[model samples]
Target: MKRRDFLAGTAATGTVLASGLATQASAAEPLKVGFIYLGVPGDGGWTYEHEQARLKMVKHFGNKIETKVIQNVPEGADAERSITQLCLAGCKLIFTTSFGYMDPTINVAKKFPNVKFEMCTGYKDAPNVSNYGGRFYQGRAVIGNIAGHMTKTNKIGYIATFPIPEVVRGINSAFLYARKVNPKAEMKVVWVNTWFDPPKEADAAQALIDSGVDVLMQHTDSTAAMAKAKDAGILAFGQDSDMMQYAPKPRISSIMDNWAPYYIQRAQDVMDGKWTAKDSWLGIDTGIVQVGEISSAVPAAVKADAMALHDRIKAGTEHVFTGPLNKQDGSAWLKAGETASDGALLGMNFYVEGMTGKLPS
Candidate 1:
């Protein structure tokens, strides 16, 4: 089996327990695993994904990984206090799941080097703390392709949150592929400036619909966008969680991340005393970044093309950043047939060639 396949299979089986039983650990040691969440775990989107991960870790580790999550913690000082409380309560492993937790995570890592820390969607790292994210830009390609084939107006609306690299990359990815199949496609983006504000996110979606955009997509975490799309009778994609129920007919598909495996593995590593500080970016091939169940809203023909693109990406035959592509300003990004380098994909700053809207300043 390929290395990726091996990782997936092992992750599936919950393997990789520690060697050398000198530590004399038990299934009942009550290893405290803490989670710092930016949004409510029951929000049914981004935070829901992480919470699902926490539950799965508990399942694999049984009573060994006692989990505690402090959700809806504000950034900055409030974040620091919440984290300190978790560590002080004897958390052996902690997962801070938000980009805004970057500084606080690093500071806490210094103070609790013995207590392993893992921050999701964060860039900073330390000896005992590591980072993990998925190639979500890859998933965006699927959404763009589906949108390109489905849109009747050839216009798309984006509900964005902040100008971070993660959100920016998704913007570029969807815009590029949408224009690929629909030459007249143009993206209109509105940054709500908050990650999980449902009313604001829904308002952004409504604004897009009012602008005559036939389709919508979001970087924000909420089912509100999907619900708005349904009420407005427009098409959109789901994020983090399968939100098809919200927009039964208008929802096309979603980008699902099965983070449970990673959470389980990391906590197990800390318990086994073999935890290392290496970053990992896993994707569809490894069952980390995933595509949600496609909805009936999409045409059958578009579904075939989307599935093919996914397979090619999984097989390493297609890279979304292939060039002769253009930035929003029409500057050539890559030569024809040239795939974008990993570095450029990681730090993607420009919108793809046919995008109409500017990245939020």
Candidate 2:
């Protein structure tokens, strides 16, 4: 859900001085940074990627910064409490890493205006809060291209976490690019709703395989889908992070969400007292989102083709949501040669043509 508009003006220098927060400095005390997560750091996908970046931040800042993490914090009221506790624990900067934590992050930020809040996969921003996320759909297009060429059954399955626009966009991008290369390819979706349930994600993977799917993709934050595909003798792509450790067979490639560079920069910004609220949606060009290793299981030609598409997207010559596109209901959404606007894409709640299954309400 969208929240209040971002505060308009910059924080006056006098505001910081008047608050006396700018004077809190000590050579011995490290600037405290806090991170709140939707799942455990060992989930091996979304949360895992963010945790890796957190580790990177620690390495980059060394003794200059001290970090704290609270894991498995559910969205809504629970998140607000977790964030509040973090602020009370002497954390000067906090990062809430999940889309569902949007409202909670904003609400908590209000009570601690001097504390900086960074939210991942959210659209809202306040004077002390910033929104940042990667364009995951860009990487989806590349993996979908590989899935199109490698699938022997021509049926691709998508294991989804929720019906949010972020998830929907990935589904649409994969379907559009998959069908582009293999006209006979059809996408089948199974929504598990929850983001990091290993059992539920595994069940969904098996269900999709039972439905004759020989290639699998997932929006959930676990390697269960990849493991299931490996056991089923099918192909799959990793979500959020590389799963090539399970590769050479079922896991042919992956969509990697790289947060290290951005995380490091934001930490530096806070240290330099230059951090401000702004929305950041970066992708392959900025190394925020990337395509992971393509295993030897994929044919060389298909790998090359996928990389070419990835390059075009990175160069801005190709758009995943570009036109001659239509909604799932056969309604024209974009005319030929037209590209989707950021507003439309951010609020997308409908599926594109050729994708099967209803978007959850």
For all candidates in order, the CA lDDT equals 0.81, 0.86
Q: In model 2, what is the error at residue 256, expressed in angstroms?
A: 1.2
Local distance difference test, candidate 2: 0.86
Residue range with the least summed lDDT across 10 consecutive positions in model 2: 1-10
lDDT digits (tens) for residues 169-286 of candidate 1: 8888887788778888888889899988888887888889999988888888888888888888888888988786764477778888778768777876776678899888777777
Local distance difference test, candidate 1:
0.81
**Which pairs of residues collide in model 2?**
none
Pick out the ten consecutive residues of candidate 1 with the lowest summed lDDT: 15-24
Q: Quote each prediction's TM-score.
A: 0.92, 0.92
What would the per-residue lDDT of candidate 2 be over residues 104-160, giving only the tens digit for each residue? 999989999999999998998699999998999999999999999988889999998
